[model samples]
Target: MPAHFRQERTKIVVTADNEVNIQTLTNWKVSVPFLVMLSDSSNITMPITIEDTLNQCFTQETTEQIIHLSPVCANLLRRVTASDPPFKLISVTPSPVGESGEARCIIQGKGIVSLEAVNQLGEHFLLATTYLSVGEYGIHFSTENLANGVYGIILRAADGREQRSVIVIER
Candidate 1:
């Protein structure tokens, strides 16, 4: 006998002794929406099971399919759609320096780049901004007017990506 029941949040459960294997299909036609709905409405504990089932079915799925299931799977598949870091910090030179000194670094990537200097007290000071082509570029900045302390040199891309490094200045 097949069992049918409804739960508090309009969740319907149907159980039967059928020999249908859901994992054999190349694409999920009816199951994706149901899994998505379960993920969005169910508690974290219950959603784990649903997420596991979705993962099993989508083992061979494409990135687009994974992205489409991310929202419903509570961002379980977010890595598939996440953006890569816009830049790589090759190196930062002269970590400890005098108040009036020059600092330089090589950054490699492609994007509109901007930088900020943040103090311990959470104060942000703009350093530089420019568009970089798809290659390695050099960055130079002066600490002539900066006070003696530690500061974070933050590099940001127009696409909202960021990288940070620290520097200490002493008199």
Candidate 2:
């Protein structure tokens, strides 16, 4: 997998024209989520950092706070907090458009799985349904004589978990 890094910073300032405006500054709150990826293919999510700076000008007080992520160290955080299942469907890459030649469907997963192909009307066609061990696996299917429409590639794990992806076959 490719690696990605990103850094972001946000600053907020408040000014007081009278006493009432200054009191509202104390009620301000901020929250941020930072993504950190680990070597073991895991991720951590937390707040980066917050810095507060107060400056006194002529007769008014200016308060500024900066929230930023450190560029030196970070990780890839998962967008969803839901726990991952033992068998994960990483991806299903199919040839987007193709002619009457051979079109392929690549199913990637973590554990044992069985794959099948279905039409747009939810009709299951037994393409390749066999138990695959724990790792990444790929299977190739022909598009010859098939209609020019969308077909669904469904992968079922040994534990009964299933993932579906669609591929378009064009004449």
What TM-score against the true fold does each predicted structure earn? Answer: 0.42, 0.39
Give the best candidate by lDDT: 1
- What's the residue-level lDDT of 61 in candidate 1? 25
What lDDT tens digits, residue by residue, belong to model 2 across residues 1-171? 112123223333322211112122222232223222222212232222222222211121325322223222222322343122244445556456354222222233435445666787877765555555544445555555456677766667645555555556565
Count of clashing residue pairs in every prediction = 0, 4
Clashing pairs in 1: none
In terms of lDDT, model 2 sits at 0.40
On a 0 to 1 TM-score scale, where does candidate 2 land against the true structure? 0.39
Which regions of candidate 1 fall more than 4 Å away from where they truly are? Answer: 1-86, 99-110
Instruction: Tell me the whole-model lDDT of each prediction, alpha carbons only.
Output: 0.44, 0.40
Give the clash count for model 1. 0
Give candidate 2 misplaced runs (Cα > 4 Å). 1-85, 97-112
Q: Candidate 1, residues 1-171: lDDT per residue as tens digits?
A: 211112222222322222212222212222333343221111111111332343533232243222122334232221112122234555455667454323243334557777677888988877677887554556666666667777877767643444455566665
Q: Choose the strongest candidate by TM-score.
A: 1
